[model samples]
Target: MNKIFETPLYPYTHHPDEDAETPVRHKTIVVGAGPVGLAVAIDLAQQGVPVVVLDENDKVSFGSRAICFSKRTLEIADRLGIGQKLVDRGVVWNLGKVFKGDEKVYEFNLLPEQGHKRPAFINLQQYYFEDDLVARVRELQEQGAPIELRGGCKVTEIDDCGDYVALEIETPDDTYDIEAEWLIACDGAGSPIRSMMGLDFVGRVFEDNFLIADVIMHADFPTERWFWFDPPFNPGQSALLHKQPDGVWRIDLQLGWDIDKAEEKKPENVIPRLKQMLGEDAKFELEWVSIYTFQCRRMEKFRHGRVLFAGDAAHQVSPFGARGANSGIQDAENLAWKLALVLEDKAPDSLLDSYSDERVHGADENILNSTRSTDFITPKSQISRTFRDAALALAGKAEFARPLVNSGRLSVPCAYDGSTLNGPDTDALPARTRVGAPAVDTPLGQGWLLDRLGGRFQLLTVDADAPDRLDVGGIEVERVAVSAAGNETLRERYLGDAASGVYLLRPDQHVAARWTSFDETAVRAAVAKATGRDK
Candidate 1:
């Protein structure tokens, strides 16, 4: 058994030899070697389930696709055990300035309070982010995780039988058939897997095409997000300048509705526009530039039989709010654990249905937010444009507009309010309710147990001495010492002085439920619901 399992990818096959026959079956076959696919593989492998990952690209791609990593994504990375490395390498961005013409309408400080260990957002290139994740997956693979990476392999077809999926994979060497208990498609927007499944990607594509360029700059710009509405270089068009690590900057120019695609790709044309935006004194060299159209869409279904869709394969949102890749990574995190559970038989196959239900809700909400953001910035009609201009004009006035301007609507965390799997709220005290808002902080850790608390499910009880009052079932419970001053301060930050007691945390770190005191029956129920043990 030890020799058979010595190679991380060996256990799923009959033997380790090159000519050895492929296994008749696998627990999971994840298509796409992108961040989402790798995340799913890592999650399942950690749980001792066999997973095989396939990618058409032989190597990781360069260029920054998504630049903003939200706090929620950071929390997810932390759960995967690579959060600190990401933080150390990425640039922490908490301040952003929104400009309308020459005037700065609103400046936001993303971190509203001190003592929080993590920032509200971080700016890192998507390529670097994937690099960290791939490294971690490789580490896990070395540690006996059953994760196989088949580079140059692409899924051509998927047959989703009730019990298993037969994947037709094409490789440089030859085409072959791979059978798995389940298939997860993380392929991008042009996903053949989605097409094969006959899922409709319903949404409209924006008419305006945008030019994106990553340039190395000699001039010093404030390490902040800068957005220009109706800039001189491209009147009635939006321009964005964001700082990247190593003096690199990402610049985007709205090319309007009528630009020729062939002309825009030329360095001569792109460089002049970039020079006009940054000024001649800036002295910058263009790294990479491309013209692409943005769209807002979501799949009709996230799952079809034994196959599931994740990341861009599941949804595509506009780039205005930086939600596209971030939301996809979140989907990966959400589905990974559920897939792991189903494969382990710790939860019934019905648990798989919740993946589509919960993630579709998230994806739809993301699409709505992105669409609204796109409308606000790129106003489709004259009336809409006028309204946006007036709003920006109003925002220029500090007294009349600060509150409205500083809503941080784009940065709001998603709430799983209408989830079918979420249990009923049974807490008597309003302070004890964990829904809508995150778990309040206690001095023992940091703000929002949802953010600071780590590793597995934790049932936190305020009654430190009432261990007998706790129910030890299929979950783990810890009676934190909230009596100390430091712990008290932490508690006060999240829960306030009026709130105290026990909280149940789900494996994903969201607060499942909370009570003013230890209630074994309620605790067990919450645990059961969270673990999908409930009927």
Candidate 2:
């Protein structure tokens, strides 16, 4: 019924079933239509599961909420078929600079190798990214993919029934009840769904506040990220400058806890700080500015019965590392395929339990890392502040201290090692070792590395002819033989040598297990445990 689906690219053909009247229920109901929520919906629809995404807003939010998309997220977007669009629209940034009082402390060039399918990071406005994703969702809807978007529909309550979930939604026009076998809450930090479930989101909220301003500017600053600690213009405070699309830039100015929250947001107070940072000669117009408090927190459990949490609903981290949204999208990617498999009966419902365990682990790790970065950037006590200043001064001179200055705190893909669903790396095979997410690189085939490995549970064996020696049933195995002398760059990046034999990749592209001799029983059992079917 949405008018956006009338375009030529949007193909909608409703399949009339004789049993269509049986109360409409989707296999999955996703709350919140933000990037993370949409990513989950798209992945589920691609795997042939019906999904419905509900949001209170009719369109993308206006603010520049999240801007940096990491390589792992780009891989997820590539799997969803929209990576090229993102690449074309975003500004690829491979370097960063850190400064203390107009002196360059350190710098980093993030250009990894040329063989990577994507860049290290892309800077794009969060609104633009969400808009493009929404367009893609509309296109998929036209193709009769069982994905539906209901805008202006607010979920008022949820009743979890262990096996399923029932939601009461209030739309602008009517109030209705929807049922789904599973529910995913991608709602923002003040999640109504998480609250309705009586979950605890415990964490610390920093006393300092930040004034976030998006502005169109003409400046000589480099495209790389710029951070200034206690610059003369903003003494006793921190500032950041990031180049965004369309000649605009994002600026965050730290406002100490002493400032009146009500009065600090006025343009009169904000523009002067901008003028001081940019100098009087610089010309610019402020687009938007607001004051926000930062928090580092995570839900104790990511999943409660049949309802799961994703994005801000599950965890909230200080925006220092830009890990808040990035981690959320990763959470969605990790949960989607498992939910799809459960719906298709390819895996048991117990597989859903792993969603909470794995993501919560990652969220806890992210919170700790981001919190540490925040403390380093914005020291609260006098002793801590003195230590931070001394550290920066030392980093400015010491070559070995440059890494600390560059702050290698970007979000990395998380593994499922300590979870109940994942098993230990046993010493059964000579050269096969299965651990962590699969490292992506240009392989023998012309297709993408992730493309070759994503979609279903894959078993990459060193020898294709050794099927008789492997008992990998209920899983798709792709046998790829690596030369004893591996690709030089890949060897240096992954295993120190190319002598490693085979790798078993999960649906999410994480390595499940590996073996050198193509031992059928070991590979089969590894796949079973990775897929939560070993029992």
Candidate 3:
């Protein structure tokens, strides 16, 4: 028989004291081994930085939480070398259907483009995703990478020196002091670390309660995103049904404010609701159930001296847009490279400030979308609901109102609009990809463009060759030359019918600069700006 409970993910490991009196010091210590923390740790380890990850629990996420992994997030995962594992273990989805009383109000497709590497989103239980990342960390350990995982450890205190951050950690049996030149907090929404420092999460909270459930069954439902507004099965409330891996399905039912959450989550109260939706005869087992109310909020500053926050620790958004985990991992991607460079003394520590600036921009984008989604889903007033209904009613027949019908905007990569680190746009790029944008994946022979670009600086020459390695400040770069025929997408994205163009890609795969031809001085300046040396 299948186990009723998900497996405990990260078993505790013992670490001996450093000499007897001195505390163990690492280059970087990451608190919380969830998807965000593990991604940051793996990224730092791959860049040759030693990391110690501490988590309070040894188990994978208890429920099928955070099932949707966005494509941009998958690209970040690919950079961390765990993309294939995540995709292989997930259910790919691209089509979403919005319904009003079972009358479909137009079907929407997320990924209209073909030949791209990943789908719009993949639905995998958060536990499996974390498990794969932990496995990657172990693999890196076997290869002698300096990444350590200490489960069942809780951070008790933190001290930020001018140059380093010190931490007090407690295990079940004893307490120990550890120090790091840098600290990354990937703790969840109620982040103990954030609370330890007394940072405020300032944002709006929707006055509604949402019930989330994971049902275990072999159902015949199609593997796609299905959202309902005022669904007849559960009237006057929004609901979402999504397919997950492991024969489990995630159901979210909106219950208005003032209900007792404890009473609602009981099987006696919840199973009947499922029976109402799935009908009386549908056989299923309850995997998990919980009630949640979300607040779209974020820290004012992601960087606090030597301590940095990423993932849920930094910002939070409603699950409607799938922004929370995806943006958090993107935060790891944005921070890791900058942190590694600063720790290596290759770039000034001010480079770390750009992390706060840029991610705040990303967080604001997420919060804005989340706020809009919540407003549309649960309009604050009857007038707003009437507007929403009229929009949805018109969406069923007309075209323009479909844009206003916001069940959830769905997650997309947040373009860094005014980031100080952004490079100048060269020519008129055709592929919607720009200098500040995350590099779009283009087909290169049989592989993908992003596969070659991550983990280090690269100079991609489209239809051109042999720009004597663009080296700057001890950072060596690889040059990839793409032929026009094999790289049709690349040409369309970067070159755009120009004879040739040079794209400077940062380690995080964001394009830093581009030129019609090679210019070492221009590349170096852009590198300086990207590393936060300019301002």
Candidate 4:
């Protein structure tokens, strides 16, 4: 086991609330100390919301559960002040190779273009990811941000008392009751909070399992994503190889639905399989091993009265696309700013409804793609297998068939196209920067566009005239002006053929509205609309 997992980062501590005469209410409470929960707490604390994070455990996660972090996730982490740490301690890769039988089919690049500050993806252990987030929380604590992480605090019961949520938490020494104006649950896939609320997931659980093994070995494999379909060693099944930090390599091997999971997990069985895959002389030590089944499901709604759900507690998808943790982190980012505004009374409580609406939209997109990838990878029937095999075979010889080959359609940021918060959009501007899409990064004179627009409602104007700042219904929108004359990337990404463009960006850095020219009335209406005050 790694030292990170052995040491308790947030050990159990007695709270004054435990001995209080009555339950003490807090502004916000986050259940679970995972990436999503910590992220939500950090964002809220930075925004001046007093938050308490309770988790059942003390140390970081034991294994490298979610090793692949996408660029969009990195960008969001950058806003949280820990993106560079992840990139620095991760194996960055954008290239992926697919294989059929013993032959290499084709390769693809996730981010072939440049001007973005981060890479397409990075491979780091989940433990490292959580460690960095917890460290960030400590930094915020030192700076007097109102955030507290309490470990060994298990939530035994929950009650949604109309305007607030009451919780029963068990600590090592004693149990206590607490209340919160709002509660955010990030308790992972098997969420007790969801169960206590009598809520359940609705979707498909495929009849297949995959054996994941994280082995520490010095290998000569290139730093890239290598996925194999019906490889020689793992015949009639699929395999995936990914490189991680600290000589750790993740290997996933398909295990048919009907197999002894316990027996297969034995070292006697697992070692031979790895030897067959990595050759007889390949030496390695097993760091972690687990078996996972495929399930693409989500709650009916993320928000349930006073308690809101984010991350695995709200939605789940097949891990083939690396959408699990990435989507969860994105959920935190989407909900944080909205929840902050609602708590501060800057926006109506109805604004939080859009959080559920928009995130459910994102969850559905991930589920759809994840289901398709699962079908292509597993192939329920012979006909489906035949079609998949044909696609892979033709993918090498034909350019058009390459798109048909699905070795897990990699994760991407979901654009809220039909979101109610989306305002007007101009077709003359670049479609990538249109309404409801995530703002694409462009290099400015000294820093990046995303860095300047960090975690706030801002007006991005390129070769357009707008006031330095605008007060729209109590929301401040600062203008970031840049010329597109010499910046070709900015011109192509934001301006296109249009001479100038003005964009209203949400605090999450998503475009709420865009136009070829600036209009104060239009911008004010957009701010109102994006904040859920349009009605």
Top lDDT: which candidate number?
Answer: 4
lDDT of 4 by residue, 132-230 (tens): 999999999999999999999999999999999999999999899999999999999999999999999999999999999999999999999999999
Q: Quick one: how many clashes does candidate 4 have?
A: 0
lDDT value for model 4: 0.94
- Put down candidate 1 lDDT per residue, 432-496, tens digits, no spaces: 34543344433244334444454455665553344633444534565544543456544554344
Q: Of the pair 3 and 4, which is ahead by TM-score?
A: 4
lDDT of 3 at 469: 75
- Candidate 3: tens digits of C-alpha lDDT, residues 1-535: 2242346566666678423488777899999988999999999999999999899888777777788999999999987878999999999999999998778898889999876898899999888888889889889999999998988789999988887888888887688888888999998888998988888798877789999989988899998899999998899999999999888899999999899999999999999999989999989999889998868999999999888999988888988879989999889999999999988888899999989998999999989989999999999899999999999999999988899999889889877767788776666554466787788887777788788778888888876765657677877777877776655666777778688887888888887777777777887888888887776
The digit string of per-residue lDDT tens for model 2 on 232-301 reads 8899888888998877799998888778876887888888988998887778887767888878999888
Which segments of candidate 2 are over 4 A away from where they belong? 1-23, 406-408, 423-434, 443-447, 462-473, 480-486, 493-495
TM-score of each: 0.89, 0.91, 0.97, 0.99
Number of the top TM-score candidate: 4
Model 1 weakest 10-residue run by lDDT:
1-10
Would you list the C-alpha lDDT of every candidate in the order shown? 0.71, 0.76, 0.86, 0.94
lDDT of model number 2: 0.76
Cα error of candidate 3 at position 224, Å: 0.9
Give the per-residue Cα lDDT of candidate 3 at 443.
76
Ordered by TM-score, highest first, the candidates read: 4, 3, 2, 1
> What value of lDDT does candidate 1 attain over all alpha carbons?
0.71
Kindly report which residue pairs in candidate 4 clash with one another. none
Which 10-residue window in model 3 sums to the lowest lDDT?
1-10
**What is the Cα-based lDDT of residue 261 in candidate 1?**
87
